[model samples]
Target: MRILLTNDDGIQAHGLRVLYKAFREAGHDVHCVAPVTEQSAVGHAVTIALPLRVKEFKENGFRGHGVYGTPVDCVKLALSALLYEKPDLVVSGINAGANVGVDLLYSGTVSAATEGAFMGFPALAISYDDFNHEGLTGEHGSYVANLVERLPLDNLPHKCVLNLNFPNRPVAECRELRICRHTSAMWEDWYDQRHDPRGRPYYWLTGVIPPEKVSADTDRALLTAGHVTLTPLRFDFTDYDLIQSLGGSLE
Candidate 1:
């Protein structure tokens, strides 16, 4: 497959580079156009107000274009103008953190794949549950690349994107892949108020979705149980049932 790889973790991220090597070794023509700096949690933001810059990054036989914008911008720019040909598959991530539960609402990793799906292409978003990248190896990337190769992606519905998350455990220790649903669990977050050297208060956000609230067989729940989770997501925001009821009452 001709693959377009991108990430929210920037072009130089270890996860992205690992995937790049694995994909190249797998014999897929891979082109990466990613953010020059980390754009995690930026969601589907675009760079409309300012001109976006594209820079080429070549180091140690790895080549990719880095965009000074959001993950969505990289996909949009690459598909619309940067690449000479449309890719057969648009793959985002191998992201450092899992984008499950409410995290999907603010995840640049998932949003990158979402943008590709919005543009009528098959897309997949890959993420790991761990934020720490220590003790990682190319095997993780190989595991992801192998899964991508084996998935029946061509059979996916139009405008659908798959969100895949792996548990923090090593690939060998992780359980079998489970097709799952995204959890509707909410984040129980709190902002920490701290004083700067000047005595000004600044707040830092930190939170977690209570494990008790996560439903069984959902992405978050399964991933926590050391299982790889795959959730097929669609972008339609229409609440048809509500529309019908509201139309009848208002009319």
Candidate 2:
């Protein structure tokens, strides 16, 4: 299969490199186009005014393009300009950290794959829950790559993408994958006020992420229980039910 790889973390990230190697070793033709710098929290924004720059880089037997833009821009350019033919699938990440719940609204990794999904292709966004590289290795990368290969892309909903989050456990301990729903969770905090060297006020946003109340089949609950969570995400944010109810009230 021909796969287009991308990520929110820049092209040089270890996570991207490891996954690229695993995909190539699996005999699939893989092409990568990622941001030149980390584009985390950028969501699904595409460049509108300024021109995007794409530069080529060769490393670890994988040739890739680094775009001086957001993760969404990288995927857009790859499909429209870079690749001569349409890829069978678009896979974003092996990202450095998990993208779950309300956090998906700010995740460039998920946004990159969503861009592909909007263009009529099966797209996936895979992330490792932990930010630390304690036990991360080629074997772990291979395991995730295999899981991506086994996904039922042929039966997925139109213009929808799979948002996958793996546990921080060792690859050998990765037991089962669960089809789950995104948790209705959110971060709660305010900025900390501090003084600069010149006695000016500055604020640093820092706080703990409080856990949400778990409902049945939530991605957060499944991930906390050590299962790999696969949530089918759609680009449409419309509340159709609300619209219908409002129409009756307005009339």
Candidate 3:
């Protein structure tokens, strides 16, 4: 299968590099086009008015293209220009941090794969829940490689993308891959106010998940308990249930 690899953690991220090698070793053709800088929470944004640049990416002998734009731009350009043909699958991540629950709405890693899904291709978005970066090339990498190689890449379910998050535990400590729903997670956005030397005000954004928002059986909570989580994501944002329940009040 021709697998396209991308990430929000720029082109030279350790997570991306490990996957590149692992996937190739597993006998799949891999291509990469990723943001040239860290784009962690950029979400599903795409470059429109700005002139995007694409250049050769080379580091530690791995070669791919680097896009000077968002993760969605990388996916768009790679499909339209870089690859000779449409890929069998588009895989995003091995991201620097877990993109679970509400992070789904703010993750560029998932956005790249989401863009691929919008373009009518099968996509997978994965992340290691640990932020310490110790598991980039260990069990987490192997688990992802195996999952990709075994997937029905040519015939994925239509109009949905898979979101996978692995726990921060060791390989042997992992319980199982649990197919689950997203947790009702919310971040209490906090700002650290500061002033520049010249007296201009600034604020650093910070977030803390409230205890009330924590649920027992969500991807986010399950992952912390040593289970890998897989959730199916859909793009249809319509509140159809509400619409259906609301009877016609006026013509």
Candidate 4:
């Protein structure tokens, strides 16, 4: 299958390089168009006013492009300008950190794949839970790459995107992948107030310690237990149940 790869991390990220190599080695036609600089937490934002730039290159026997825009811009440009035809699939990430819980709201990685889904393509956003985890070299990248190659794309739901999160453990220690739900979790926020050398006030954002809830089916809980969590995400955010309860109040 022809796969278009992208990430929130910049074009030079180790995660992107490793995943690109793996896709090539697996004999799939892979094309890349990622941000020129890191665009993490930019959400599903696209470049609207400014002109976008695309730079084509070849590295490690893989042909790819770099985009001077957000992750959503990369997807839009690849579909409209770069590829002669739409790719079979769009895969985003191998991200630097996990996009779980409400964090998905701010993830550029998820946004890229979500953009593809909006355009009627199968999309996936893969991330590792560890922030400091390095590239998919030797066994690490290979294992995840192989699993991705074998994913049951043919049976995927329509208008849905997959959000995959792997445990932070070594590849060998990883258990089987688990289909799970997005955790009903949220960050306990805090701020550190301080004065600068000139006595100006500033605040540094921070979070309180996360507590383990009793839920048996959350992406975080699964990952914490060494499972690869696969959560199917949909664009529809409506509260349908509530809508029915308030049916036609004026009537």
For model 4, name the residue pairs that clash: 136-141
Best by TM-score: 1
Question: Could you tell me how far off, in angstroms, the CA of residue 205 lies in candidate 3 after the best superposition?
Answer: 0.8
Say which candidate scores most in lDDT. 1
lDDT at position 218, candidate 1:
93
Between the candidate structures 2 and 3, which one is better when assessed by TM-score? 2
TM-scores for all predictions? 0.97, 0.93, 0.93, 0.91
Q: Which regions of candidate 3 fall more than 4 Å away from where they truly are?
A: 244-251
Cα distance off (Å), candidate 2, residue 78? 0.1
lDDT of 4 at 112: 92
Question: What lDDT score goes with residue 118 in model 3?
Answer: 88
Candidate 4 C-alpha error for residue 153, in Å? 1.5
> lDDT tens string, model 2, 82-159?
999899899998787788887777899999998999988999998888876455678867876787678887888999
Better of 2 and 4 by lDDT: 2
Question: Pairing residues by index, what is the TM-score of model 1?
Answer: 0.97
What local lDDT score does residue 192 receive in model 3, on the 0 to 100 scale?
99
lDDT of candidate 3 over 1-251, digit per residue (tens) = 78899999999888888888888878888899998998999999988999899889776668999999999999999999889988988999889788888787899989888999989899999888777676666556678888876767667677678999878767678889888999887878989999999999999998876656778688888888889898988877888877866655432
